[model samples]
Target: MSVDSASGVTVPEPVPAGVVLRPPDSSVRRNQRLLARLGWLYSAPALLLVAAVTIFPIVFSVVMSLSHVTVSGSGFALGGFTGSNYSAMFGAQLWRYALEFTLAYTFGTVLVEIVLGTLVALVLERLTIARGWLMALLLIPWAMVTVISAELWDYIYNGVYGVGTSILHDLGMQQPNLLGTPTAAIISMAAADIWKTTPFVSIIVVSGLVMLPVELTEAARIDGANGWQIFWRVTLPQLRPTLALAVLFRILQAFGLFDLPYVLTGGGPGNKTESLALLGWQTMFSDLDFGPGAAVAVSTAALTLIGCLLFLKVFRSQVGKEEL
Candidate 1:
């Protein structure tokens, strides 16, 4: 090519050493496309099943929420689409109460769970003896079915001849009916939730604690950092993501608060303990108002999604500041 340039004639550039030029193979690309198509074909059944199981129900629920639905012997009879369902939900005082109660319950329980769970995880992380046995014991509460756990709590809070009542009576609190009143019922439900789910949070946090880089803590200690200082400065920042994940999971589950209130209080004491889930159930199954019920469900889902998004945004901003 240089000699051809000197000769002032057009010439192809010389190929670099250890390089080869060749035409692209159309067959290779065709084979790759075929494999991709085959993979999609193989996955199509599972995708369809997932749609049937999850997506269809969601879409149907949204549709039901938007329509005038009536229950018949045949099935749900859907009438013309209307906004009455959401309007009724918005105008009803019971819906407002349930929304407020559910939000309060979710906030209180998730906050307590995160704090208690993180403490438990920290303690568990430092324990070198019987850690597995301790963890198994801790997990018992979480492993129990929610219904069964609620039932057990129900028994404990029974107005008469119950263990909690008996202990309270002996402590000079006479006739302390734990679930007989609004405030007491709310507290009892929150206690049961905290007791049952704190272990779950602890497990997640413990896993994160286990995976944290030990070198950071050691370095912090070598720099004259105390245990509290190390925890605040070195440990907590790294654990932010794990804590955010735990918060997200707990918020989602707690916002759908139902089983505990249903089994323990039955949304009783003047429906003070009624949650959005309980309200939806009562509206649909008890009142046979499927449209408003679906609206309640859809609203709960939307609120939960919004709350989680806001939390994640705040968490990300906080993490960014910490990183900076």
Candidate 2:
């Protein structure tokens, strides 16, 4: 056998090593591929939904703004084209009224919310008893439906049998019709907004307050810092980011406000409370002028974007300085 093996060029026996080779399981590879595909499949519905709901509408609106469309006619048809809508908006004095009212509304509401919200936050921070209950109660205004709050405040500002009128009479003053006069109506609507939304701003600021390091405040106190000094130097610096965020949110909300003003004032008393949104609504629905209405909406959106960008830039600068 040995002689025969040499003659046939026999091969040596294989030696055992530390390593082994094996084929990957086809099932495992298939399962991994299937899982990856399934993950994407699961997310497809949400992506499609977002595209359909948000992206589609935005694109449609942009296109509609460039063309003329009527609510009663074929929706967003391309044939009814005109630049006259935007030209009319720019040339008319109505734009000035809308702009002035929008600015007034935004500033009035945001200013009140910030000041009153900070005050409330400070009060909440100082409280030691039933703080949770108080916080919950403060949130009630924000939790209520916006339309309901508008109606409630509307009734409160009513000339006869209104609580506001009653209070004025009790104070030995003639009860002025708050919702009738232009100045008073604007102030009254803004006050209603402040009452409803200040709690939201307070909640944001309170979170910032709660997260502030006690050590910094204590150090300030040990350095003989008074209440005002501590607040200005130690507390406010830490809360700048929160305050920025709160103000930005409040501003945006106040800028786009429609339902409350619509429900309460109906943009009445000589268009004193007519915000950009309300004006757009009137143009589109009341006048059946879709082109101008869409133009107003587009302009409003651009203004909002500019405002937001400015806020973000300022916020980033402040945050950077704070970090340093």
Candidate 3:
């Protein structure tokens, strides 16, 4: 016990018992830990669902790749495991062609879309009036679904009834089969993709344009710089980060290149336009070679992973510059 000198009252002092009182911060720490656990409990279901849908299939296929699995009358069983699956996947000539075509298609479409979309964005950003209507017109192509747009293009390029054929016939010359030859089919498919997806790029560029500083452009104009000079120096560099991000988005989507090629070319004209995704699908589903098919799927995933990693470096550069 202790005595207060002023009040002359006895007060309880510290107890020396074995039970120790927790400090306020310790109590708070305990409460935070409890809440964190509860948060994880709440999130567990979603995490499990994602694992089931995405992680499980990837792991399963990886396992399948190591086995001699085939779509036989017997059920799937793991035995005769060998590296032959990878050998078959890499040894094939068709797979190489598909891979090359996929790369070409991705780059081809992305290049055209970026150029065209940037041009459209520049034009729209300079307009003084009716941009709302113009924006709507711009989004029309992007709003249409990819498969539908591809099918539309397929009809447009139809050998017999297409507009191109009609025009050629009117000119009194041989109606060149647009989708019948390998090079023409690939070019036609790329054109369809560019037509459908360019508006999306334009939307991204336009968003970046809206955030651009008018003062910079004004200063350039005051310094007696021409329109082309100002835009080439000021506008394009400002848009690079957004352009990098947009390219990543488009490349991821374009590298897959499944439904568009499927609907338009059917990997036709002797499989000249087969994308990696389509080839993987055809191998896994159509041919029923589970081992080699899984290998194809893995290889495609690796290919995409490399592309994504490369873009991530560019994205990181953008982020670093912004942080500075």
Candidate 4:
């Protein structure tokens, strides 16, 4: 095809087969590829750190749990392993008691914390004055170092000069040493935990409460729903996910409780307050039995992981139903 300039008439150019003319600049594609590579390079340090800190320790612990290794004893090699540690733990009566006590303590503390925390959150949310100061005051217990909190509580529960006993006596209540008896010790531990962690749960619940759409509650109110009815029918369902997450975290924290019980009761008056973590610590450090202790520690980790997964699954299911 050709065009004649003088005649001002043009003939169409023939299209070439399988030929295409595209824009020349490929910098955008090149930059995208470059960026992808840079991202991986930037993330390498974090990935390496995680592997070194988290993955290596987890693998080492698993290996240690299966072998007979102690502070003075080293008969078993790392690669050469046995199931004796697990077998011994499973065959023991003390293991059962440890498990039961751990479960009881975890459940009791978490339950009380959640209930009290939720109620506090509700009241705080409804309050129009002094809420900020109250929240700050509630956080003081949480802010204290765990060991310090334990020591403080220990002084308060002391038999001779303890304010707790004095106050009880003043109220016409006969009070023994708080940590002397098993039941009382467990109750005391739970009280300390509730005092420390209820604020944490309240913070989580309060966030959810604040994020909730007010229209739903107002609509329910307009429909003549009572306060309790509105709460059960509206508020509770909305808060389920946050509550589950908070409770899951609390359960894990309570299950691994050591410092408070250690300082308060020394896991004593006998092994009444002895949790699985404390038992594992005693086995590893005090008794110098690394193999058995690592096994116990591994079991605790596995159980905690399972509990968290179950909680998340249940929470997801509930949230899904609510969404539907």
- lDDT per residue as tens, model 1, 250-307: 9999999989989998898998999999999999999899999999999999999999
Q: Please list the residue runs of candidate 1 whose C-alpha ends up more than 4 Å from where it truly belongs after superposition.
A: 1-24
Worst 10 residues of 2 by lDDT: 1-10
Note the residue pairs that clash in candidate 4.
none
Q: Which should have the higher TM-score, number 2 or number 3?
A: 3
The most accurate candidate by TM-score is 1
- Poorly placed runs, candidate 3 (over 4 Å): 1-23, 314-324
Per-residue lDDT of candidate 4, residues 32-114 (tens digit): 89999999999999999999999998888899998867453544345458899899888877777888999988888888889
The whole-model lDDT of each prediction reads 0.93, 0.85, 0.87, 0.87
TM-score of each: 0.90, 0.85, 0.86, 0.87
The whole-model C-alpha lDDT of candidate 1 against the native structure comes to: 0.93
Clashes of 3: 0
Error of 2 at 290 (Å): 0.7
Candidate 2 per-residue lDDT over residues 1-324, each given as its tens digit = 133455686555554797565557997799899999999999999999999999897777666677866454555355466777788888878877898889878987898888889989999988899888989999999999999999999888888988998888888878678888888888888888988999999988888999999999999999999999999999998898899889888888888879877998899888888989898889888887777888888888889889899989988997888788
Model 1: lowest-lDDT 10 consecutive positions: 1-10
Enumerate residue pairs that collide in model 3: none
Q: Which stretches of candidate 4 lie over 4 Å from their true place?
A: 1-30, 73-79, 173-175
Name the top lDDT candidate.
1
